[model samples]
Target: MLKGEKLGAAIEAARIKKGISKAEMARHFGVKPPSVQGWVKYGRISKDMLPRVIRYFANEVGADHWGIEPGDPYAPDNLVQLRPKLSAAEGMVVIDRLSVQAGMGAGKLAEHFPDVIDNLRVSKDWLRRNATFTSMKNLGLVTGLGDSMEPTFSDGDALLVDRGVRDVKVDAVYVLSLNDELYIKRVQRRPDGAWLMISDNPSYEPYVIENGDRDHFQVEGRVVFAWNGRKL
Candidate 1:
């Protein structure tokens, strides 16, 4: 069955071929524009809504486009399984790995807008037991750069970032952008309604953003997990 990015690509291709706008599709499905974007971007949809999605597309672009037998819209074998078996192990989820890197030293400019470079498959049970996230689709992987976050996470570490966190909800490590540059640093809200961007290494001085200068700072996401690549 077509799943993951493949499924997303298929849906996008059919939508484009049919000349259907995302807003129009959302209205047809009784969902918001972002929900349709999620289906096209992450290839995920609720199981209960799968049948409707299949039928809608099948009718719009014809069943031949999706390799479904004619007149058998509900055929089990032709169904597009949203949660496909990612690995040999069952109950696994795929998290997109972004091509962009988050610098832990002096900030770096993103050469290009971030794109999905690959997918990281992890056990659902492990994710539920370890990570505190609202949804699996919001999680992404990025490689860390520089030694500013050493001892906690060295350079070249792989980090799990929650893209859904666009603001500093609590004092924690976050992937943020300052003056158009990207950085991974610990963020703390100051008592005076400002933000303190701190590096773990003492050599680098903390930077503070006052309320007036808040326009230059933007929280990209929250860093939840780090996989250190240090050798023993």
Candidate 2:
């Protein structure tokens, strides 16, 4: 929801809070230092780069700092609110479908924070029977692209993500951002605190994030379910 100067201010606040230098930010975005300075000074960024900028800064700080309510779009205000109320009578729960696409192969840019492109309604009983979660507050739907996860979930699958699971609590499939690209991959934490990003398809080589370079990796959410054009 932040735009123009407000957005710039939010980015500056996040940069300062995260202790990221402008030069480092420029390197990350592949721009000159002055471009990043202008982003903080004037909030000028192209439409195409807006999503990436938002995602980077939002992740550095928090989505709420940018007025982004990830899974609940109809809240009365931007301030964090309770999870969406389930219509017990109807036995239904509405989950937001986000514009972000989690690539399974070569990776893609993570797009649109808290932007609901659509909504998927499912029976509350179904969710209880199928998904495992402590709360339903951060449940969302994101499209998966590429064939790296084939046999598990094909390309163009609709993945049910739990945004609340922001860390590698267990070895599982997660939507993560690595080196500025978004991907859906199985992640395992090594004993040494490094992370192993594995593709389900053996054809693709696994990637490792060394313990010392953890700054380039971030777990955005856990993949709880995949609607692969079939049964949920």
Candidate 2 stretches with Cα past 4 Å from truth are: 1-89, 112-114, 229-232
lDDT tens per residue, model 2, 97-196:
6778879998898663435545567888888888876567689889999999878989889999998997888898999987768999999899999999
Candidate 2, residue 127: lDDT: 88
**Could you give the C-alpha RMSD of every candidate to the true structure, in order shown?**
10.7, 10.2
lDDT, candidate 1, equals 0.74
Estimate every model's Cα lDDT from 0 to 1: 0.74, 0.75
Error of 2 at 53 (Å): 19
Best by lDDT: 2
Per-residue error at 96 for model 1, in Å? 1.0
Model 1 segments more than 4 A misplaced? 1-90, 229-232
lDDT of 1 by residue, 46-85 (tens): 7666555654444235444444453554444434332231
